[model samples]
Target: MSRKPMLPDGLSSYLAERWRGIGLSLVIVVATIWLGVTGQLGLYIHPRYFIFTTVMAVLGLVFVVSSFVYRTPSSGEPVSARRRAVALSGSALLLVIAAVTVLALPPATLTSATATQREVNSGGLDGAAAAEDAAALVGTGDYERLSVKEWVSLLAQSDDPALYADKTANVTGFVLPDAADPDNVFYVARFVVTCCAVDAQPIGVPVYQPGWKATYDTDDWVQVTGTFVSNPSARSADALAVLPTTVEPVDQPSDPYVY
Candidate 1:
């Protein structure tokens, strides 16, 4: 008489029983790799963390592969159908959500609308410590290249705008109108992302150019070149009001943040 084939004992049967878990794990691995490869991860996180994140994902993938290959047999009988249904539902729900979010919503950079809603750190939250750090870096030379965060910190740390009056600022960022006074003033702002987009903070230098409102709209990325004029009405104390010599439209940089 022909005998019925038996289910493979050990890990293979275990994986087969909980195959949904394995499938979800594989999906995560694939999604991570896709994000890293496509460069879309930068839209959601700081580039500095990408390497570490990808490394961890790779390790997880390795674990998944080893587990499948080891094929340990389950000593116990298969789980009950009710329990199986619950397990499958939970795992499938998570996988579907993640997959749909990644695939359905196109990745996008946060705009000035978000800037208005979130805290705009013209001087930054670190207060004195950030100011000191900015001062330290200023000594490294090339004041023309001061970052939005540095300019913000400097203004916050020092009350004197005369110190920055003669300096020239060459910065790149999107425009955000000063809501209190939209026509004559606007901020050239960049978001600071320490880890991910969720924690991004806007930092900007205020520009005072007549007709600025007519010339540019909010969220227009531009290269701003200007002379610093220390003015308390400016965005911050260290932020000298930029009298833009040339506010030229430019394509957004590949890496838009201060770092």
Candidate 2:
């Protein structure tokens, strides 16, 4: 007599119980194709998306093949052992792929300059010192709170001296692209957040200097040490301003996102 296959009794009945897994596999395949076609796959963990997608396709194929093979009565041997081995192997492979992809991806904090500044400023630094320094330069009479749109206009229309007459005003922000001029200037900006990073609206000052172009790229952390200079071409009627101080480059601090 031939030996029985290494499966529990009623193994054929048990195989029929797993239709849910097969259906799920079909759904996954459809979703993956849709995401890939729509260009939304980049929103996920970049490296793992493709690997997981491939795994889904393979799993679906395996289920289809297994279902067909197991349906044959003469192929007698219980498939339970083989099925369990396949399940365990696929699961282990998936976990390993996930781990590798996560490790290889670029850290999100490293890509955000605003995050870097917020992390440093939040540390037990001297807030009073910063405020006092700003006050001394802006002066009680000269310090004016302007709306973001107004600020943008002033930057576009006015010269820097109008705001920097006192010559020591302090401004803080991250860097953003300049729509008006890409080659010569960029916006030093900060995102104003209502609750967290999600709703942040960027506000920035336009920086214009021939030397700044050569010395710094966008997103570098630097302290501007110069007095304010007004640019007449800026949109602001109030005179768009910039600190002419030397830029002191700093390392990226932990918890880089501000909003």
**Largest lDDT belongs to which candidate?**
1
TM-score of each: 0.71, 0.45
Q: Encode model 2's per-residue lDDT on 1-259: one tens digit a residue.
A: 9677555545533444443454445455545555555554443323334567656666776776677557544344455555655654565565455544443443343223543344321232233543444455334454434322233333334354655465443444445445445455555554444333443345556666544557777777554444456653354322344545655666654433332
Model 2: ten consecutive residues of lowest lDDT? 118-127
lDDT score, residue 206, model 2? 62
Clashes of each: 6, 26
Instruction: Give per-residue CA lDDT, model 1, range 1-259, as digits (tens).
Output: 9653243344334644666777678778777777888887787788888998888889989988776677565668866544555665677787788777766566679899889987666322476666777777678767776777777777666646678766778888999877665667788999887788887888888888867777787899998998777543544333457888999999988777765
Candidate number with greatest TM-score: 1
Error of 1 at 12 (Å): 16
lDDT of 2 at 208: 60
